[model samples]
Target: MAQTAGVKPMAIAGRVASERERCIGMTDAERAWRKQWLKDQVLASNEPVHVEEYWRERTNPIRRIYRKPLDVLFTTLAPVLGQQRAADYRYITGKLGLIAVGVLAVHYYFKYQGNDWTKKGGWRMTRTKPMVLPGQPGFPYKSERCKDSDYADRGFSKSVFGSK
Candidate 1:
């Protein structure tokens, strides 16, 4: 008859209203106990809920590092270099060829040449003098320096050169 706060009256037909009235005759405590018992029965079931397991599995952080296209190409090709047999070598070589062609296609699409600049019109290029530091000497023109600079040390140099 009277609406309670935050509660709306159900728009039930005559037969449904009679059925609901019969149902509502049960005590509040009885209804509450039955509701809690149903909830307990649901939780006590033996079957594992895969939905919970799926969410729990997803909570783990993924550790793999993301690689760029060039990084992936090099990484794949590096292992193939160690292949010894002719068939394996040929297979790897073909894969490498495909990767190279893909790289070249990307290079052409991006219009990136060996040097950065692309000359437009009939522009002439000018050569610039190399900038040298005040104290540091310019690059050695034609001298043959030892490949290993560790041998440049006095004690090691004599032993390495067999002049000690």
Candidate 2:
């Protein structure tokens, strides 16, 4: 609430306040290029700079990398799909891609690094300890007894469920 005299809150908050402030350390060519970029990309597109900046920060690098290609696709298909439909397709595809990536990441983690038992060279489906129960054959010590399958092979079927 307490703002400095003759200075906006943005300047006080370490943001370059205006074109002049942004140009302070830049060479003439750099300044001209920057001004042209702002004019063509920001102003011509009718998108607010702050809103664009917010989305840039919020989205991950993967999405940013895919954005241009997707934009070109939608733009090219715009005549057939219409503007609204093209936008919807773009949005849906982006979200679905994100979801697919997330699902694959989780699948990879669970497949390899998700469980402590796996890390310790134990059964993938169960923990390190054997799943032997009272009144069962190999009641306490034999790990092979706890597994649902009685296969003697050294794979998924041989291991039993356990916490430890």
Candidate 3:
């Protein structure tokens, strides 16, 4: 090859060394065969081939098969807790176990005692009686019945024993 103007000697020597190394491992006949094969490959193909097409032609069909559901689940759960970079599985499992134990403890406590001990003093239970509102057109304060009653005083008499 003719030397170009202003070309560095180190660059030219590196290129020559790389070329020599490439051919050095091959036998004379094997080198010739490789050269001819490469020439044929370059000259035979004029059509544009996509990257996907090239891989599909070269790769095994079974190897290309994908577990989509597993991949999606792994991707989703990886951030939460798994073999992912952020958190170790052992630590996460321990924390989850503690939480489970706490939940169970609370559940059993409530089941046995029927109330929470933590908030025992915070809350109180009280009974309330229903009030009778005045001027509702049902009964008078001191009278037996209202003026519209069909059976006078019988319906209002039941209120004394808290029957109605």
Which model scores highest in TM-score? 2
RMSD values, in order shown: 22.7, 14.4, 24.9
List where candidate 3 sits over 4 angstroms from the true fold: 1-87, 115-164
Q: CA lDDT of 69 in candidate 2? A: 86
Q: Which whole-number lDDT from 0 to 100 does residue 102 have in model 1?
A: 100
As a TM-score, model 3 comes out at 0.20
Model 2, 1-164: lDDT tens digits are 35567665442213233656676776677667666665654453644444877888988989778698888899899999998899999999988999999999888877766545235553445447667779988876755355554343334343574312
Please report the candidate that would top lDDT against the real structure.
Answer: 2
Q: Give the poorly placed runs of model 2, Cα more than 4 Å off.
A: 1-64, 116-164
Models sorted by TM-score, best on top? 2, 3, 1
Q: Which sections of candidate 1 miss by over 4 Å?
A: 1-84, 112-164
Return the lDDT, model 3, position 110.
52
Tell me how many residue pairs clash in candidate 3. Answer: 0
The clash numbers for all candidates, in the given order, read 0, 1, 0
Clashing pairs in 3: none
